[model samples]
Target chain A: MPNIKELEDLTTQVRRDILRMVHKVNSGHPGGSLGCAEFFVSLYQEIMDRNEGFDMDGKGEDLFFLSNGHISPVYYSVLARSGYFSVDELNTFRLIDSRLQGHPTTHEGLPGIRIASGSLGQGMSVAIGAAQAKKLNNDDHLVYSLHGDGELQEGQNWEAIMYASAKKVDNLISAIDLNGQQIDGSTDDVLPMGSIKGKFEAFGWTVIDIEEGNNIEAVLKGMAEAKSLTGKGKPVCVLLHTIMGNGVDFMMHTHAWHGKAPNDEQLEIGLNQNAETLGDY
Target chain B: MKTYTYKEKKDTRSGFGAGLAELGRTNPNVVALCADLIGSLKMNQFIDENPERFFQIGIAEANMMGIAAGLTIGGKIPFTGTFANFSTGRVYDQIRQSIAYSGKNVKICASHAGLTLGEDGATHQILEDIGLMKMLPGMVVINPCDYNQTKAATIAIAEHDGPVYLRFGRPSVPIFTPADQKFEIGKAIQLTEGTDVTIVATGHLVWEALEASKALHEAGISAEVINIHTIKPLDDKAILDSVAKTGCIVTAEEHNHLGGLGESVARVLAQHRPTPQEFVATNDTFGESGTPAQLMDKYGLNSAAIEKAVKKVLKRK
Candidate 1:
């Protein structure tokens, strides 16, 4: 594995990739994607036990399901940077006949994506099922999932949350990007999800908190801690308190950039903020 | 015309369980999931036999659909069993995005479909599952005729690699199909031969169609009885061939006439060959709480209803 400095460089490139991909299409959710850059870098580069190439059946490797699929920019970046597919294909992010859809799907046979997820509130259940399958197969590898804080409002998350804990799905670790912002406004202003950590604990899960979700070291440590908490008769939940837009200066501190693409000048400014670390995808 | 008889009455759900248990013995990769309807879906034997392969997913049907889609990622053939109402309408989006669009090999085995859901009333009965499932691309919609055919279809679907909606009933209709018959996915079975009016039926209405054919024979009308088990990817050749000779058709199902088997048959006939058709289905209304027989009769889904429909179609011809 690469050192922390190398991982940080990968993170910088991922942010650039996210900015450019969305700018090219003039669509996609970049606020959450920028917020999740470090998390994706830490997960694919440091944490996960992956294979040399991607296969639909993630049999031996650690499986990850992106339930909050609007943030496909960062996912595609990390996947390409991690060798799941060619980095050049990231250019075709929402084009016609492009495998890279606005949301991640296996419909076009994208290698790393196990299930289709633009429809929120369904991924947690899918991750739970894959974790259960790992148990059934006697494979001890873990299953991980990431959901937006606003995506939890879909109500299917609660059904899966209740079920995962009740069934002791100890092989899974679910992380929510607690950015406290959504498409409309702040999550509190939108729907006011009362105490996400309290809710997870009440549903019988071991909860971990990362004060700064955008920090690479903090994300790496928090996820490692969550991994250690697994297999103890409860699924682990990581409440990652991240800023909606982490790296770029003008995009931070608001949910206004949640689904809006950066224009040419804004993209140039955003690209300048995060210099080409590992070269642009 | 050849006559048909049954020695016993059996619910189609039992055939599902029987087929599931057989798959448990024969195929190792087959797994089953249910959302708090094990007894009603008749999945006890498979659960009792392969406890590990069977999952009790509580009362969350949407989660059940999502989980079933996920299980297919690891080379597992997942069969989800639940009430038809919960299976289709309750989680249509989950089935649409996860299973259908993703093209997962999951079998959504729905029991207590249509008005024959009986006593559970309109809320529990699902008359639009065939329409809802068949509308999605690559989704195969199958409504087996009898208990024997249902069992065969349940087993055959695990081998086919895509999403399938297998709709069955709660009532113990006649076990008329062969016990050891090969279940074809999109083929229609010709139960009787005639040249007057073709009678195509599925699910609980199949037995009723046979009775209508017998009654039609007595009435001097040569009604051809064709059992259309698969609603989508329908046996258009069988329908067209029968209709070319008969010149008119009657479609019977325990569902609404709006989007049920009749409409699918109508689409095929309208595209390929124009034929006068009468629909033997509910007139787009919710079912009421009553016995299966009472509900079928009240909703006009009985043998008498099919016989009346055949006469109505004969006049159009």
Candidate 2:
């Protein structure tokens, strides 16, 4: 399931493994990990169902949650090119016994981290409590999340988007990365969330906007219409429209590469825009 | 000196809805979140006998502590409930990043907590939730102390394995400890054995350190209660072997002698047995609208302020 020119050569080798793992751990957060490299390479190469051996209680599949964890270099380069761990441990991202942590963590048990976020709006309440524990283990599966529209002015992500729309939770699917920039600048002059899709449709959610979030076929048609608007009870939210530093053209539109790093000649013009595909960690 | 008789008093949030409906009928991965304070955290009998492992979550205590830290990611065991000041200072960084730095077995529980939540003063009284859940890292704080040790520390923090907080209270006091004992989490519970001081205590001040150890065993000054009920890995070898055979210590708690359980048994008796303690608690202030017996006698936290802090730490030994 890989084409858009092999997902733009795996989003340019996940922005050259996020500028060589944040310039060899001189620190991390390369502008929301290169503006969330085509939404984590179109959700781990064409929208998640995932399970090539990465189970930390992912029971019967689909589960993702990186609540804007300072985008650990596009989530450790699409979890080491979608295999979950070693791509030379992405050269130890935030080093010193790194399970790639500068933010995402499960205290190093790290087989696709079940939890431990960079303390933002708590990853849509841990993906609506893992989609309410996959509907109490009957395992209908599906729970994904991501955030950082200036971490949605964090009031605990509006108390987890008003508790996944008053408990309907509908298996879950959340997203934001609206990249209006942050780390101290334009989130509308810092804090103006005015009309974040009218604040998640006034907190009952089901929103969806994706104006080509760096276009991996419009992020797989806005994540396949956010998974057919999840089970149809409620809880959806999309809004993508990224570019915090998308494929690094001079680290795209400001916020000074959100958490800097690109030194060696801006990581060779951010690895010549788009080519390395699946090799280069 | 036995005389302990209360037969009926209840409200340790209905012993956490009768220990979460007996851990949802013997743990089928025992769930239950809450937030909208389901009848003030009594959790309507485990949301009426497990309505598919109950999870109302309306008031959103920081997204019910991140969906009880993502329902411990598929292993379930959540718990949550609310109001010990919105379960520890309104979702303390969503329970310090989705349940204590992601150790996540969840269980926060909490009820009215200190100053007995009477008339909802000091904004639903919390008194520093066992020093903000025992300074986090790995967490397991517990508070219990009545309604048979908060229904045996809510069926022993559902066999423990990580982030717990438990706590309890909200008026109707006296139930007197043993309704079928066996709770344990971090041990402690000595109860009587005396030798001059060592009061110690915990939640609802362990019935004010068993009425200040029955008034220091009727003034002959024996006093040795103990009962910490787990305030984070702090059994410290039963508090340094009961302060090395009771040399001098007092404690008690309805919380707030800064990070309570009397500053974690005075920092484990000042880093191992340098004794002479005292505390009895609540002196750092902040509680109002009386009657949890006049705010446990205006915050001295009753049983004659743990029998005057066990005669002021046995007159500094």
Candidate 3:
């Protein structure tokens, strides 16, 4: 497992991967992917209790589900860097006949993905299901899931939210990427969801707020604390307040780069902000 | 000519419940989830016996679908029970992405299908479920004809390794098929054989086709009755072989004419045989509040309609 400094280097490299992969394709989301680099790095590097190889049925191990799958750039990067698949495979992101789809999917036999998720609000339900399965199997290892804050407007999330607590699915930790943006505009402008933490609390969830989501140390500490709350008869929810685009100066605090890729010049500037660390694919 | 008869009547949903209860006793990996339709889908026995294995999803059909897909991760074969409309149209994308495209081994058990979902009107009656399910890639679509066949299908799908849509209805129709009969997915059953016209049917309409065959026999006509249980991965060879001998065909179903079993048969005919055919289905219309018998007759999904279609197709031949 990587230390805080080493994890920071890996997080920088993931940002580079996101920018490069999306730039080569001239399409694919970059903003949310960039923002989630620290969380993904902290998760794969230090958080999850993973096994050696990949199988469809992830038994006796902690599993992760990405509810907001448009950020495949970050997911594919961390998955590759963590040795689920070849790091070189990141070059084929969203190309023809590639396992790296525009959204995260298990359809192409991707090693890290257990379910397909690009259609919003479905992941919470899937995560709850997996958590229930762990209970049925008597596997004590927990299930972790990440969702976009704006994706909560989809209504299915509330249904899953109500179900997880009602059924006492305590072996699960669901994290929300509070980047405050969507494809159209800021979530406030698009569709305001007032007091997300209050909403989860009212729905009977043990809410954990990570105020500095981009900060590596803060994320690791927050997630560890969230993990401690597991198996105590309530599903945990982490409100990670992250920037829309954390690494790049120009992309931050705006939703313009939510799904747009950087140009060749913008790519160089973005890459310069975070120097090559652990090498690129 | 061969004749068929039923001494008792039972709803196909009860067959699903019986099969689920049997699976609970036999297969440890089988789990049941219902969207507040436990009573309607007849899942009470399974829930009663295996309280831990059954998940009462409480009316959220979309969440039920996604959860069913997720349960497959740890090798749990989740069977989701709901109304046909909620099972298909209400959660099409969830099924498409989570179960179908992801290739999860989940059995989507749907009850109250087609116009036979009496008195609920068009809102609950799902006449287009077969079309919606069949269009998805790698989705096995099954519409069983009676109680015995439906029960057999419910148990059989758990053994099959892929996503399947098992469609049945609410009406307590005649129990004609054998109770111990082996339900083979994608295989059509030949109920009666003749040389003049082929009468193909599914779900509740299978009995109607058999009745039409008996009527046709009395009217100096020989109609071959074929029970098409599986809609997609259709038994094209059986249909082609029968049409080759009969020179015409009549497709009967409790679904709409568009994108239903009739259209699938027509596509096979157009590509292979191009035989003259008539459809005994709702003519691109919605069903209304009425008894199952009244709706079946009004929507042209009864034995008399099948008889009329056989006569019409024979004239074209």
Candidate 4:
């Protein structure tokens, strides 16, 4: 397990990467990516039992799929730092001929991505399917997935949630970045996903709550508990309560920053909050 | 002209089921997923025979599409079974991102396509599926004519890589195509040879085309009948060669005239070798609840309509 200081440093670096990548492209989702930085760092550094060299099927190692692919900054950062690719490639995000598209895709022959999931509500089902595949292959590795809170409004996510529980996809762990904010406004004001934990429990999932998803230690403990609940004949769902922009003070608790990149001055302020623990890409 | 015989009449969905069962026995990598439509899709035999390889995903077509895409990651060939309406339109984005765009080796098996879905009405019958699927890049669109052809196509798609849409129907139709005929992806089958007009058709319309050819032969028109099972990656050479001799074409299908097999053929002909063509298909109207025969007659997807279309195209030429 990584110490809190190391995980915190990793989170800072990921936040820096997210801001830098989104700023460079001038078009990408950065708020949710910044919020989910700690969770991703903890997963890669401690939680998941993944192989260093990537495999498409993830045969003998744990697998993760980003259902909320808009948070590609956090995903790509963690993936690169976890040794999937060089960290320098992070600069080419959303650029022409870059593997890191505006939305996460497997079409560019990225090693870590098994399925393309820029379109919302499809990732949970894909993750469930991957979990079922692991069972059929007799590989005991677990399948992990993450989705945004606003994405729950999509009918396909409900379909997937119903299926994962009904089909007893116990070898899976799904998380919701319950940031309560979308591109428009708060989730309550936009579509209102009321009682998300109760919703999953009602769908027959083993639900757990992480009160501070932005905190590395809390996120790690919540994920560990989620892993333990797996293999017990029920799918596990973690409702991660996180701030939209966790590191940068000025960007937090606002919907304006959900998709918009920071200006020159705001970028400098954001960079200062997240010091480059690992060298900046 | 050689006449065809139907020993038994069967639903094309049953052909898909039989093909899936056979595939299970032949290839260990082949897996099946049903969104609570195993019986409707005629996939019970495969499920019963290979219980471990089959998954009952309830009434979640979107989730089923995603799962089918994920199953391909481990090199497993997955066949997702659902109604034509749910298979293409309901879960289009899932199919687009996970299967087509991602380039997963998934066979989207859709049953009860077009007006043949019968009494369930316009809500159930899907006339735009062929167009929707064909529009996607790298997607193979297939609409087999009979039980034997559907079975052959099912087995053939498993061997080919990338995404494929295998469309079948619910009602029992004539089983005319030979069981021993080998199935090719983009090849059109020449059922009869003639000199005056070319009759091109797909799905349930192939039997109609055959009947139309017989009727035209009696009237001294000698119309050639071609079965175009594969709509996208169309058999241009066969169509152009036949049109070169015939000089006119009549396309028929159990779907809307717009974006159906007729339009696809017309596009090919217009680009390569332009020929006068007439379409015997449903107009831009929704299907109503009725018997399969009633719907076919109401939509003008019948032998008489095909025959009339052939004469009309020939007259224009």
User: What interface RMSD do all candidates show, one decimal each?
Assistant: 0.8, 7.1, 0.7, 1.0
Compared with the true structure, what per-residue lDDT tens digits does model 1 show for residues A156-225?
Answer: 8899999999999999999999998998899999999899999999999999999989988888989999
Q: What DockQ do you compute for every candidate structure?
A: 0.79, 0.33, 0.85, 0.75
Model 1: residues >4 Å from true position, as ranges?
none
Residues B107-161, model 3: lDDT tens digits: 9999999988889799999889999999999999999999999999999999999
Poorest lDDT segment (10 consecutive residues) of candidate 1 chain B:
B120-129
Q: For model 3, give the RMSD to the true fold.
A: 0.8
Ten contiguous residues with the weakest lDDT in model 2 chain B = B1-10
Per-residue lDDT of model 1, residues B181-217, tens digit only: 9999999999999989999999888888989889889
In model 4, where do residues sit more than 4 Å from their true spots? none
| lDDT by candidate, in order shown | 0.91, 0.82, 0.93, 0.91
Q: Residue A61 of candidate 3: its Cα lDDT?
A: 92
CAPRI-style class, candidate 4: medium
Fnat, one value per model: 0.68, 0.86, 0.75, 0.72
Ranking of predictions according to lDDT: 3, 1, 4, 2
DockQ of 3: 0.85
**How many residue pairs clash in each candidate at the backbone level?**
0, 0, 0, 0
Please report the TM-score between candidate 2 and the true structure: 0.41
**CAPRI rating of model 3:** high
